[model samples]
Target chain A: MPSTAGAALPERSRDLRAFAGPVVEWAIWIAVLAWVFWQTQRFDREIAQYAFGAAGWPRALCIAAALGATGQLIYRIAEIRRGRAAVPEAAGPEIAAPESAAPEGQKPGLWQRAKHLPIFIFPLIYLYLVPSVGFYVATPFFILGLLLILEVRTLRALLGVTCVVYGLVLLLFTRFFYVALPVGRIESFYDINNAIIGIARYGM
Target chain B: MEQFLDGTFNLFGDGQAVLIFALGLIGGMLFGAIPGVNMLTLGAVLLPFTITMQPEHAVMLFSVIYCAGVFGGAITAILFNIPGAPENAPTCFDGYPMTMQGRSGKAIGAAVSCSAIGGVASAVLMMSATGLIASWAVRAFGPQEVFALIFFGLAVSASIGAENLWKGWLSVFAGLIIATVGTDPVGGIPRFNEGSFFGLEFSSYYLSAGIHFIPMILGFFAVSEVLTQAMHISKGTRERPKAGLDFPTIAEFLSVRWTMLRSIVIGFFAGILPGIGATLAAFLGYSQAHRWSKKRANFGKGELEGVVASETANNAATGAAMIPLLALGLPGGALTAMIMGIFQIHGMEPGPLIFVNSGDLVWITFAAMFWANLFIILLGWLQTKTVVQILRVPFRWLAPGILLLAVIGAYALRNLFIDVWVMFLAGIVGYLLRRSGYSAAGVVLGLILGKLGESAFSKSMQLMDYNFFGFFERPISALLITLGIAAIIVSIINEIRGADVQKALMD
Candidate 1:
């Protein structure tokens, strides 16, 4: 199938992606504020000697942050209501670089905008598995998975990176720093960890 | 003076001492530049092996490593945006930006010279009045005064690169709140620890010890940065950042001399405090540089002064930290504590008696550090010449390595998987915040400064019977806090008068 840019999209639909970006950012800001407010509210009441107790400092911070975010959001919305592109005036350079470089004449849907999803998700999976599958076992696959997702298909690049990164991890963490690193609970994974440790510590 | 001359002679004339210094320089730079491993790790690994060595050689080795390690971190911070240690975090703010701007060589050069300046100056101060300064620092800078310094640092930090004052403050507040997650300092109450589902007994148990800095720093600076780069690749917007050896000229060094000196003073003094050390010194140096700069607008956008301020102060702190350890028997930080362990292994205690009983040893250690700092200029430039080659590698290859390093960096802090999880989570948060016109640096500043300030705040409160106004009774504390408040007010006024406060935030 053609990429989003390869298939020409309707101008209105194309603009919708641009329109949705700020809307999503706004919603995220609001959600985060709510969560922070709720989290601070959950702390137990204050101690007498403490300056407003365990809850005071965080609660004070929560109020201050909420006020700032709320104020900024309100200003942004008001500026937009007056038919001004105020966000573009000072909107994030971090967001700008990618947004400006996006393929033209395309309708960038949520998926189009979120091409970084795999990069973000892969780490979570790798992190969750490390404790169970062992560091030495899981790392190569983790690296391979990232390389594949990022479209680095060259055999030389893939093998070179995998070996160098994995070797460095093994050498620096285990052999040099002497970190125990996680061995894992499953018998197979345990053996995998042991085999590597034995090879590293005592030789093959 | 005789001891000093003998110490200098020992380092230069003795083959063993010369060999040890060379070993320390290489080992420190190697370990300190690695993602998760640092000089402290190197020191810990070497501690058991140091027993057979002579006492003077053993102690001298660690001092050289300490000086070199602090500067080693700056190289990684400037080139890769991967601060090898927490103290190098501020360097990343400006240094990495310069790398992207193809000024990596200049940034590295600034880091090298200032680090040398800081290290040498601090060594001089440490040798000249170790006992006197340690005693004066202890008496003058109590909890209240320390709180004032942190308050001032945080206040200036919010305005460092932030265009919108409120956005910066919001970022700071969020950081302060996030820092309160593990536990309340005074009461040991688990503030944000997850409770059981449906009344089943559950919590992380150890969270009362609080969030670790390693995970948070890795998440914010490294992991999130990878995501930004990945986004560009996936969107077909990939562009290789500029990297070269356009090192700074002598004129550039002269330009930042004031910042260099000021930061060294801050870093040296900050290092003398028991719990607070190089990390605070670095952040404070960066913020103070921003506060005093004629071109404040250039900071965090790749200012040479920013790199000079942070690297110099952090290196300076290494020598200053030994002051308390040698003079008052107090460990200024973890690395110093390890050096104390070295002293104990050698059947020597590091108090006023150490100087009286082993005057030659103290001078030798001091001379070793002074010389070690001088060598950093050459070694650091060599590193800059070589390390910039990595920038030629594609982001696809570098990102995975960085992430893997991030995982280990986080977990190794306490060998807790929770830290790794936190690192990923913070990365997600950091990426989102940066895209939405928020200041991640402000958040970081708040987290570190707030953590240090909270304990001081608690102590000051108790010292003054919980009366908030009583803190201002102390002249130093009063002056610092007043300055902080004035800065906040001035920034707010600037915003009201239609200043471009939103640009830095949005940028």
Candidate 2:
């Protein structure tokens, strides 16, 4: 059945050709293991000569792991051949449909969806900006931004919940956990931050 | 052993330990009840206070949190269909079904009781076994064995990612690479750090910036859930959890006796393996139980046995994981690793030396685990009613509140803005991968075990002359390797003849 599916595809199309799930899983692993092995190749080869040192166990383990990894790569290849192949399902509910029907733009295909790089990249940008904005400053905005994207209703509820939640967290961590929350430069704001810091450092 | 016995007696004698246990019980109940809050965050949030505590007492607080976290997750899972942890995801299957049938109280009761039993059983196993294992492990000086043990750990994790072995391996390798990003432990040279970003070597290795697990955890479990919840809310209809608890009948529990016993054993054994942790133990135990269950067809549709297997195995894994941690000074899971870190920062090295050098602390910690498990039962039951109430909050209010807490929790880890970003990215990845049928737990476990396996393997290489057999030469290492091989065969056999095994076990 998979062979027929594969044959039906355009011969030159590199993407979306039918392949077994196990095959795809292995192919991805081999690529990763190969990269790791290549990264350690020089040191791994050099370390092969030295013996009977304080470093003996750690180095040997690495090479053994590389070997184990290599063995797995081979096994995966074999397993992939024995299994039925899959082409990403083109049929699935759309995300934009009714909430019970589908989530926003989610479909069954994998390769077609990887094109949306922005979704994956957004979080990284958020993390980079968090400490600079400070917990108090950043959390409400993060909450508000995420809610808006998901199309949450009622701005009043969102604002109320965001403030209450953020305020509660500030009370808990600062008062209870005593975490040294980041407070960017400001002489006037220094004391409050310091008091929080002091509590975190000593009180808890 | 004598000291361990004495420490147990001490907790009862002084009542201070009991008070600590109470705090842990309450904390675990509350943390587990809330959707966004998890044990790791609770542990981290509570860590600073423990710094001034006696090592044993400090460990007790965290241990209570661990045991309770497993059971606590079911509160919302049963009532709201929201899993408190990734491990608890399976719980929502039967758990919520029982709730849907208006047996919410009974479901919570059975879950709590089974979880407590698993917890206490593993604790008993750990107490009895730790001394014996520690004595042997402490005396054994085979670098080959250590390397092999690490290999065994890697294999367990690798096997868990059966269909997606490659992605699993990549996750492990990524962790290994991350482990090497800092200064080489033996070589003492910065291998991965390009240099100071602005004249300061801003790296986990050079700057002693620890890789904060809590932030990562919060990001993956808490933050991701919030985003998913947000998406669900926008869809119009939201799940509102019903409140309350029910005590189980004697017959109901008696029928599950064999399952409970089997799960406890599985949990205990899984716990013994380093880095395997409760989630896998619960998963494996539940899978086995499901395969063998008389009501196999009722599993995903919400069988009581499903909840029993998952909860018991997870809870048992908690205590069992500590066996390796205490006996060998090798951490059995991520949370224990954090505790191990605390021990190191406090100038206590966990290996064989710990048993001999820090005998008092060792005994105390072992004793603490035992009592903490017992305390988890009392704690779980006490907060049973209170916790079920939290499930009553409307999804809209609860979702935003949880989202806020997730942000705070992520930010609290290292007080870094960047971790918040990591959480966000992980959330998106988690959501996307989950939608694609890839398990988020797999990813997290991969990220975790991958690094440990790499470091241990590398350490072995640095010692031996790249001889692969170094892993097998040591007796324990060889045993673990054998177990890994056998487990793979068993998993395969089980998968192939799944129906037969299910029939035989159920019968």
Candidate models: Cα lDDT each: 0.80, 0.59
- Candidate 1 structure quality by residue, lDDT tens digits, B1-507: 676788999888999889999999889987788776688878878998899998888889998988888888887787777788888988887887788778999998888889999999999888898989988987889899988888887777675434367667777877787788787888877787864444564567667667777788788778887877787788777667677797899898898889998998999988888877898899789888877888766776778998999998999898889998998888977778888888898888888788889888899999999989999989988988898888888889988888888888778778898889988898898787766567666777677777777878888988988788876899989998999899887876666444543353432
Task: State the weakest 10-residue window (summed lDDT) of model 1 chain B.
Answer: B498-507
Where model 2 places Cα greater than 4 Å from the true spot, the runs are A1-128, A185-204, B1-18, B31-111, B126-130, B137-213, B235-252, B269-307, B317-372, B459-465, B470-475, B489-507
Each candidate's DockQ score against the native complex? 0.35, 0.17
Worst 10 residues of 2 chain A by lDDT: A89-98
Across residues A34-69, which tens digit of lDDT does each residue of candidate 1 receive? 665666656767776776787777766776776776
Chain A (alone) TM-scores for all candidate structures? 0.73, 0.53
- Residue A165 lDDT, candidate 1, scale 0-100: 90
Best by TM-score: 1
- Model 2: what TM-score? 0.70
